[model samples]
Target: MIETIVLDIGETITRDDRYWASWADWLSVPRHTLSALVGAVVARGLDNAEALRLMRPGIDVAAEYRAREAAGRGEYLDDSDLHEDVRPALAALRAAGARVVIAGNQTVRAGELLRGLGLPADLVVTSGEWGVAKPHPEFFQRVLEVAQAPARATVYVGDHPANDVFPARAAGLRVAHLRRGPWGHLWAGDPEVVAAADWCIDSLMELRTIVGG
Candidate 1:
């Protein structure tokens, strides 16, 4: 039985439409380059400090691009409300006696976003604070340790294929892919990630069935 559920914050729990565009603009790289950089860092087992040292220059360019885009549109990016079903789904999981937490790459600002949404997570793991990002083993390891959860007993639910599904699977946690909505397009075309999932669902509500909570 799954005793705990760990979620990724950005796209999984909260629905922010501008995230990708903002990120792409912020880092001055195409969306695919951000994906590739994440993969490269994880593949090389580079820690946050080192990865930043190598990628920050390029990332700065991206960030500036994003800033300019935001200014042009008179739009400032921020986290959106929790998915309609998130609170109810999480409450149900809690009622069923499972612990819930969030694991993602976030900064202090992001933590505030969770609080504003009223998400029922018992723990919050941020790569921004951890100095590492997902798809890296350490990111999951630290979160698991913080949650005091055994890998086999915990299930992680997220949106990204490499950052969310694959590494969580490698860490020995069962994975649920949140496969719909904006980010849904990212997964639909990727054969490797689609094939790797233990379970795939279009919404967080579907998790209740898989883990029997």
Candidate 2:
């Protein structure tokens, strides 16, 4: 039985359109240009933040983040940013006696924003809070700890193959590759992603069937 469900934030629980657009505005770059650069890095398996550095060589990305906030535009995700299926799906999972956790590689301010949204979850945490990011073994270890259930009985769902499918599966957690984000839509047909994910789903609503009532 899937007693716990852990989900990634960006492009999993939410759409990433606003995120990329905001960054483009912050950096004074064209939206399409920033988006294309992000895809390039993602395709090359480099960190997405490399897109920002690529836009402004030697730019202090972290400092820029603070500046953006001080200028009244930092990390922001509102009700509209959440995927339509998020609240319903999470609520159903909890009603089925499953623990729902929202975990992802997001900033501390992003964590505060997420918690402020009050999504139906047992816990909403970020890598900034944990000091460990995905594709790292320690991150999955912390996932298991938050789950408080055996890895085999927990499911970790996300859009990124390298960060979500492989490592989560390797860590003994059942994996669900969600096909809603760019990384997901782009890599959905990749052989390794297909092999690593125990379940490949197109929407969070499908999760109700996976865990079952």
Candidate 3:
């Protein structure tokens, strides 16, 4: 029986549209242009780590864009309507005695996002707060310590193959891949890592079947 359900917030629970849309006004460039630039950077042989470093400068621009957008529109990015069944699905897991925790890499702003969306999570673990990010076993270790649950009894659900599944598996937890729209295709292309996961599902709502809701 799965005693705990750990989740990644951004792409796993919330859709990617909100993130991309938030960037549209921030960079003062078209969203497609930014996406193309990201592809270009990756195509130029920059590894994911390097591309992230290169993109760090754009964070300030994004912040300004978000501020302006908020002022003009009076609304922040919309977390795609929570999956219709997510709330009840999560409640079912909890009813089955599973502890739910959210482990993610975010600035201190994560709490606001979680509370803002009214997502149900028993604990929120963040790299910004811990000084370490996913794919690093230490991040999971810290969460394990806090959750006080055995790794074997926990299942981590996330979107990224490397950052989510692999590291959690290394830490001895079952992993569920949240294979949503486009990003799902990107992850599926990675045969080796995708194979590492115990199960993959198209949505959070499907997790109950995987872990026996």
Candidate 4:
């Protein structure tokens, strides 16, 4: 009965408004330009990393992100970066006897950041630790192994339809699409994608109704 709840880190649990603005400031690009870049990538169904590389070929995106985290500057979200609804929703799930965890394509430092934020997660796993990314069978297999949950009894919540919704569903897990961030807002117009999700919610709080308690 929905014993395990898997959540995406970026956009799903953490809001990115301030984060993106910070990135724009760091790169000396106008906020609108950054937004346009993201939009262009999403529209072309291209990876964001590819878009960044095309925009500035020599820059190392991963290293830049690491530097930002180290310097305490630009788009690095901490405990304060969490959306208001995250805590209460997660707390409710835990109280309902559910094992909630963070599963996403984050860096090695993600576990420390999530823990420091005091997020209500039993575990925080990343692509780094699992040696694979989302939409891959191995990634979901790792998640299932860690949660020790059968597909039918688990629900995955995330903002991206491709990385979060489709893949988790393909793994036989119920999916909840939280329409808040770039991917969510951009893909919201696709009726087929929207309807495919077991639950399309505007807030994390709605998870309570979808899962239980």
Model 2, span 1-213: residue lDDT tens: 889999999999988899999999988899999999999998888888899889999999889988999999988889999999999999998988889999999989899999999999999999999999998999999999999999999999999988899999999999999998778988999999998898999999888888983
> What lDDT does model 3 reach?
0.67
Considering summed lDDT, which 10 consecutive residues are worst modelled in model 3?
45-54
**Candidate 2 ranges with C-alpha deviation above 4 Å:** none
My TM-score estimates for the predictions, one after another, are 0.70, 0.97, 0.78, 0.89
Give the per-residue lDDT of model 1 (tens digit) for 97-177: 788888787665566556655567677657767888888898888868865768877888887776788899888888888
For every candidate structure, what is the RMSD over all alpha carbons to the true structure, in angstroms?
A: 6.4, 1.1, 3.9, 2.2
Selected candidate, larger lDDT, 1 vs 3: 1
Ranking by TM-score: 2, 4, 3, 1
lDDT of 4 by residue, 1-213 (tens): 778888998888877667667777777788888878877887777776665676677989879887887888834457678999999999988888889988888766765667677788798878877779987888888878877789888888888878888888888888888888878887876786777688888998888776673
Candidate 1 lDDT at 24 equals 52
- RMSD in Å for model 2: 1.1
Q: Candidate 1, after superposition: displacement of residue 100 in Å?
A: 0.5
Best by TM-score: 2
Error of 3 at 55 (Å): 8.0
Q: Can you tell me which runs of candidate 4 are displaced by over 4 Å?
A: 66-75
Q: Report the error of model 2 at residue 168, Å.
A: 0.6
Model 4 clashing residue pairs (backbone): none
